[model samples]
Each structure stands twice: as C-alpha cells, then as structure tokens.
Target: MTGPVRHLHLTELRARVLSEDPAALEAWEALTNHLANVKRAREKGPRGFEKYYEACRQGLHRLSLLAGIKGISLYTSRHQFAADSKRAGHSHPQTAAEMGHASDRTAVTHYGRRVQGRPGTPLPLPSPEEVKTVRKKLGPSNGPHREQK
Candidate 1:
C-alpha cells in the first residue's frame, strides 16, 4: 500500500497511523485493507461515490448501535466536534478551516453556540415602562417617513 500522507496535525490521529508503533500500524493496515476491498468492489460494479458514502453511514450507524449511543448521527457528531473544538480554545478561523467551512461566519452561526450562561436561557425583555420611555424618545419617526406637506 501507499505510505501515510500528512493531512492535519491531530496528534492522536497521527500517532495511530505511523509505522513505528506496531499496534497502531496493525490497526492502520486493517483499515487500509478494508478500504482497498471497498475500492475493488467499486471497480467491479456500477457503485460509485454515493454507494461508498452510504456504506460509511451504515457502518457508523451500526457502530453507534453497538455502543448503545442513541440519537447520534453524522450531523450531530459534526456539530459536537465543532463545539468541542471551540471549547478547546481554537479560534474561529482555525475551527472553520478544520471543519471545511467556507468562512468563519459559517462556523460561528451554525456550529458554535453562545458561550455565556446556560443554553436555552430566556433573555430578559424590556419592561413596559422602559419600552414606553424608548418609544417616547423615538417620537413620531417610529413609523415610515411621510412627505412633509
């Protein structure tokens, strides 16, 4: 098979792929062998990328089931990973790049949650008096502008 190529600097993942470690090397070999079998299956049939993707999804589902983890899906795992990365003190741009987001905004808006306070805590609204005072300060300009007669 081919030598391991450097993709990212994930220390744990990298350690598991290097040939210097016998157990890790064996695990990597088994993974590569399985992938090769999948590639051979693709070459022998009309199955393409979609089939490979579905197979991966099925495998993940089976693993989750075996682990007794309920409500874990691909999307949920992605969201969790993004949140975990953020919590681990990674910057927005760094997390976005790692997650393959087009921009940092995507990572913040979709994956990241508000860091302050408890999640789902209702924000306090302005009191009636406060609302009236603000409205009074705004005056007649609150509505759409009208042409002066």
Candidate 2:
C-alpha cells in the first residue's frame, strides 16, 4: 500500500486520505485497508475476499501511474476528459465512461484462449476419421476428377 514515496505508518490514514488527492490517495487507502482486513480474516482461509482486495490494489496502482504520468489525479483527469469529449460531440452518452471523442475510441479486450484447461472450453483436435472426408472431397491426385493432371 505504501509506495517508495515514503510517509507510511501515518498517525491517521483516513485523515491523510482527506488531505491528499482523492482518487489516487483513496485507492491506496482502500488497498491498505483491505489488506489489513484480509490478514485478520484469513483464519477462515480465502473466502473470496482476496480477489476483491487484489482488484482494489490493481486499481490503486493504475490510478497512481496515470496520475503521475499526466501530472493529474484520476478524479480531475477523468473530469477533464469527459468535458472535452462532450464538447467534441459525445454529450448525451449514458455513463461518463462512454464519453469519448469520435477519433478517440478506446477499445479494451480480454483476449483469453478457450482451451480445455483454459477459462472457456477448448475445441478438440481433429481425429484421423475426421480428416478422411477431406481427402475424399478433393479425390486422388491422378484420378478422373483430377482433370488438370
């Protein structure tokens, strides 16, 4: 939760969150709090809290990186992006996430494989019996059907 920037073991984490950048600081605060809670709750052994906590940590890291790169926190940058997108003609979009300029379409895809051991069911390899029909369809190389030969 505490990054290389230092200033950990704060006298009060919640208070620090209030004074810091909301989006970036809040994310790290959430991650730190979730970790603390999970550590204490683990006596029951991985009751699905780990995944949610991990998501929080990932979100925090993402927001922090974006904030550092853009010299703006996620909260402000998102607002600015939205305002710009709306002015550029995406005014009535339902979610703020949907507000993007025409040329600024962003696509996110989770390209996971669908193999047997994979997340989705995988297709089986063709058996010898399956390919026997392929040869029949084309016929023999020197057969009557092979007119060019």
Candidate 3:
C-alpha cells in the first residue's frame, strides 16, 4: 500500500470477481472501498478496521502458500520497491519521498548500497601542525583575562 497497488493485482481481483458472477462490479467496488462499514465503523471504533486489515494479511499469506511462493511478504515487497527505485536512477531524496520516508538518510543508509570499488575523491584533512597554528592564533587574544586588560 506504500506505493500504488500493482495494476495486475487489481486486474486479477476484478477477473476473479467477474468469473464468479458477471454483474459484481458494484459489489467489488463496495468491498474495495470498504463502504459497507466505513461510516458505521467510524462511530464504533478502530477495532473493526484492525480486524479487517488482519484478515486481509492472513488471506495474503494463505494465497502465497497456495501459489507455492516463499518469503513473499510486506517487508520483502517494500525492500524490493526501494531497491527498484534506486536502480531506476532516482536520487536518495526522491526515493525517500516516494517511499514515505521522513529523511533521505534512512533511504541511503538502509536501501542505497554503494557500488563496491568505485573510485571517488577523498576529502583533505588538515595536518596536526596546521591545527596547532590555528589554535595558537585564536588562543590568547580570545582568552577571558584579555577582556579585562
């Protein structure tokens, strides 16, 4: 649900429902929209919504088992989405926004694996002597007693 549900998924569901009865579009749409309980359930509480979500998850698991698919779950799907986004030449920030991440760092750290052996420029580090020279120049004049003097 993070990304748009695959069109194939919707197509398959529509096919399955129509196979049972040709005139089930309204019924299918009702189910898809959860219109049956939408208004009434809001007044009741979120327990009904939670129960529906769990049932859908269980159904997905059962369907995966029936199809002989292993290791297909929400996490794997999300990981694949992130990996695919990276492969498609999207920047970390773009991928992060598409995947609903708050920060690009999360996308980079978790999903953006750097290509090994890629050459890059290294940042220059100042030498110890340079640091000491800077400290000496900034030290005595900036000291507390200098203000009094």
lDDT, model 2, position 30 = 70
**Local error of candidate 2 at residue 23 (angstroms):** 1.8
Question: How are the candidates ranked when ordered by lDDT, highest leading?
Answer: 1, 3, 2
Put down candidate 2 lDDT per residue, 1-149, tens digits, no spaces.
Answer: 22121112333334545768575476666768866876666654666566655665667668878777544333443454334333333212111123221111220111111121122111122223322322122222221111112
Relative to the true structure, how large is the alpha-carbon lDDT of every model? 0.50, 0.35, 0.47
Each model's total of backbone clashes: 0, 0, 0
Ranking by TM-score: 1, 3, 2
Question: Can you give the TM-score per candidate against the true fold?
Answer: 0.47, 0.21, 0.43
- Give candidate 1's error at residue 55 in angstroms: 0.9
Q: Report how far residue 69 has shifted in candidate 3, in Å.
A: 1.8
Q: State which candidate has the highest TM-score.
A: 1
Among all candidates shown, the one with the greatest lDDT = 1
Total backbone collisions, model 3: 0
lDDT of each residue in 15-114, candidate 1, tens digit only:
6456376766675677578779777767867766457757778888898999999776767756765665555555455544556543455555576353
Model 1's TM-score against the true structure: 0.47
Q: How many backbone clashes does candidate 1 have?
A: 0
Off by over 4 Å in 1: 1-7, 11-47, 66-68, 112-149
In lDDT terms, how accurate is model 2?
Answer: 0.35
